[model samples]
Target: MSEKSGHSEKKTSLFGNEYIQHYDKDGNKCGTSEEKTTLFGQTYTQHYSENGDKCGISEEKTSFLETKHYTQFYDKDGNKTGTSEPKESFLRGKYIQHFNEEHEKIGYSENKKSILGTKFRQHHGAHPRDESKKKIVQTSASNNDSGDGTSASNTSSSGKNFILWHVFAGLFLILTYFFWQQWLNKQAKEAEEKWKNEVKIIASKVPGKWLGHASNTVVTLYLTHLYGDRFSAKVNFRGSDQELQMDFGKGNYSTSLFLTSRLHAPLYFPITIPAYNKNGVVLIFRGKFANNGKRDVFCGQLIFDQNWKILGSFQDSDGSVGYWSVGECDGMPSNISGNWEGKWERGGLWNPLEVNQTRFKLSLKQEGKVFVGKVSYIGSRGSSSLRGEICGDYINFKYRYGDGVVREYVGQAAGDHISGTWSQNNSFGTWTVSRK
Candidate 1:
């Protein structure tokens, strides 16, 4: 017999009042009949193995005239073998017996009328050699011809705690994952705020005039902060006024720039200006910073590409049509305060070869008679500090080389033109330059 949900009937047998006889799946020898549950007169039953694993299942119910016992058997693999109807005997509604399909005696239950007029059930099955079957499911002390049997107490465990352990483990893992995701979100938010603060610090250093020196033209840039990562740019190429940058242009030659590009160290902005080359050229500036902090400089070059070579990086000057360098500059000087570039030639200079022609570029900042700025020569691929002064049409300037050597230039200025002869100690050269 197995535990059931519906009502289980009381069967009176020759022994005393008890449930129906319990047997194994094949009805051969009885396993310990577990106290599967005898509810408030319940009827359905579930069977489990010794290790708390489900093995087989069967149930039984009693009627007025007959007793019906339906038993289902299972194999080791838990597959259903078959169901059997037990051969039951109720002689004169008093004596009863239960038999298997092989007609061997298995167990039995009988009904007895008590003095209180209630029917009492008693069931019995025992073997002398097998003490397990001798364990009784339910019994009473109104002894008959049957030998005394001890009450069957459940000796098996159901492994409910093992299943509960698995349930708790799953819950714990879910909670850990939820908290981990929350932590990641918090870290991302903090990083975003830190980046914004850094940009704000950088923004304060911006919003000023930056000057670009090129072999072909000199460019002046005015930056004004508008909002987060945004600004307005007005690019004046010294000469080209109507021509505007592609991405920075609003109609009628105005601009509102978005700072989403390969950023500069001191000045970060997009530079996609229109360069007129008769075939309508556009110059996409990719400048590399020489320093990683404020007041830095950037240098790059423009290559004349008939079919646009997609602008990518400013790592080197491998392909150069005209080289350029940009830097933070003091506001435009008053007079004779612009860029001048030309070539210089001298006889018997260091490595003499007829007349060694060297290119020179000067960015001048003239104040009264004193002017101070930067100068670069073609042989010296970098710029140096320049300081000079102009008295009327006659001007004189000197630049310091990297090795602390000074080169002075004395020239006569006429409008935007300057013709001079430069001397560096015991070396001298003739030079010609003009304002860009």
Candidate 2:
């Protein structure tokens, strides 16, 4: 049947004259034949059967001021049955080759020119010796010429070699990737350990309260020891940022206070100078951590005017300087002294019981910065005495809950509410209290 577009599908073309057509559900080419033009002005037309099998192709080319034509033919099953081209010398004599239903070449026709005249002679049952057939026949003869044992042995040895090479390559790559990951992990661990060491060495040296006294206000400093050598210090004062004038003071304020056999350079800690000042004296605290049987000391220095002055200078008890102890301040005026609605949770890692949530009543009294409280379950299980201390926003309390079990409460205070974790007998849970 002549081809026509079907199923509302249109032919698609990459270029003006070239088209790529798709097939229908039954694998039938349901569109017009495609034509392609080459850059050299060569045109190729492909014709497909209704079954979507390419049945024929025609190529036209112009070379050396002459036009050439080439055509190829295919069977209904899309097998190349024959071709018509004068340029191929081999096909000039054998113009056509006939094949059986199985596509095995069975015969061919050759045009011969003898003394009589040019005539076509048909040779039947004479197959063509193509490249594929040559390789098959040669391989069969080679395997047969040698003993069967030798041939099989060679094949087996070659396969074993190929498999061994691939196995070794794969294992090598896996080991390389594993070692690379291990190296990365080792680097990270070393960096963390180094940081911890630095922090620890810094903390041990500067272990006291630092103070800066100006004429109007006193700047209190508290250094909280943290993991490694890292520490967080709280500076308590109220004024414009420029009012707190500070200087590192005079002398080498860094010294090693611990015993270590190795001789190492002193490690300096970071200290920011305050802008607040009393009169014209600027005060600052400075210190350095020490290693290897050395002691590290921090001292306060007061500079009179902009130059170093001996009048306002102060230092830690390093024989020539004086120091003061830092004190805690009551957080806010809002005292947590009233009845509160409380929740008590009973499970922690140390407790064997399933976690339970219960309600309780808490009575608290605050005296200065100290907290004394009692908590009782709703069913009157008897209340326990509580004692704790509040530091800034942090509150910590502990109570004995009858059975020799001590419950500790640590949390932050938020106005009228307190929320924190509670731990008892190695078990821990959270609690919340709101003013009632």
Candidate 3:
């Protein structure tokens, strides 16, 4: 039955030191042959029986020198029986133990004590009372011994206190915001009240009325060195309603007169008297003054006011001795205050010829009782200038022509229209004026 006699299969040991060869009944190598060995530095060998059953295993310390192999034998129960060779090595500076099939150490030797002995023992489940476990147990015991439960109770109390403090802080902030808003509203109301009081005080300081007079009149009597007598009339005004009224008596009148012309004659002349708050006076007066067989209409306006009294009057007619001591209407000419355009009869009936049509334009301005203006004449003789004055609605102006002849004119102004008469001299027939 020796394998070498070819009656049994020859097999190699797993450690590569032995081989087995199978044979047939004729004692020749037959069937399949197998070789098994440990790979690399594996120092352990496991063995099986002919029936492909795991039987036993052997562990050996391998060396480089002696090519000795370890063998394992098993009974029917697959337990190791014996071992053949053992190995040792000093190069690794450590010793190893070889084990039998039953996991019992067959030979034991020490190589070196492990530096990570506790870790190794822990991995192998051999460490007693590990440090992490010990700390956990101690902590559990300490928690159990605190009889008042102070740690947990303190933490819960602190959490409740935090919630209460946060609520109180939020309420305080809300109350502060409301109080600030109330203060702002109070300040705004106070400011508005202050502004209203100031305005009321300022309104109380203005004056109630203006100063001026209602009307004034002036009359002058002149006696000639020979036998003639003359009467001069002038009016002064504060405003339109405040005026001076003059009444002339019967006398030989040769002195100049000025009148304020009116636009239209009213049924009754308006005599306005200025009051404190009532309508202010407009100095207007119209009447008739006679000389020789002709009657001339007189109109005048009061142009100045002083201390609520009429001080100056302006007559819108031509006159000499214009500036008097009462209030000088110096160099005043009677002319309507408006725009005027009109045509006049050109020539006289002597030659039965009408040539060189006459066109006239006049404007007057008044300051208080005094007035100044200009008149333009457009005719075949070209254009000329005349001085003018304002007295109510009556206007008079005169200009000297190149022929050394003086022409006098009278006109009236109302609203946007004016009309008047022109005389070549004081005795010539009158030329009519109509607003264009």
TM-score leader: 1
> Least lDDT summed over 10 consecutive residues: which range in candidate 1?
145-154
What is the per-residue lDDT of model 3 for residues 1-436, given as tens digits with 9 covering 90 to 100?
1121122222346786443233333444332212223322222223333344433333332236745433332222433343223234665232222334454544322212235431100011100111112100000001111111111011101112233466787789999999999999999999767544533432232112323222223433211121111112222222222211232212222222233323323223223222212212223233333323333333333322221222222222333112111222334334344555666553321112543555666555556444555556765445455565454544445666667666655444454555443444223222455544
Give the better candidate number (1 or 3) by TM-score: 1
Query: What are the runs in model 2 whose C-alpha is more than 4 Å off?
Result: 1-327, 330-334, 346-354
Name model 3 segments beyond 4 Å from true. 1-339, 346-357, 363-373, 379-382, 431-436
Would you list the C-alpha lDDT of every candidate in the order shown?
0.43, 0.42, 0.33
Q: Candidate 2 lDDT, tens digit per residue, 22-76?
A: 3333445443344544333333444444455554433322236556322333332
Which regions in candidate 1 have their CA more than 4 angstroms from the true location?
Answer: 1-158, 242-320, 328-436
- Cα error of candidate 1 at position 132, Å: 13
TM-score of each: 0.29, 0.28, 0.22
lDDT tens readout by residue for model 1, 1-436: 4222111123445675343333333342232222243322322233433344444433332335655433433232434333323232353343334344343554444444457664433444421111222222221111221112211111211223333455687789989999999999999999778656644643565457766644346766565766774545554532432111223221123232232212332334434444333322223333323222322122222222332211111122222222233453233323778888988877422224657787878888888878889888766688888776554554566667777766656555667888655555334555788888
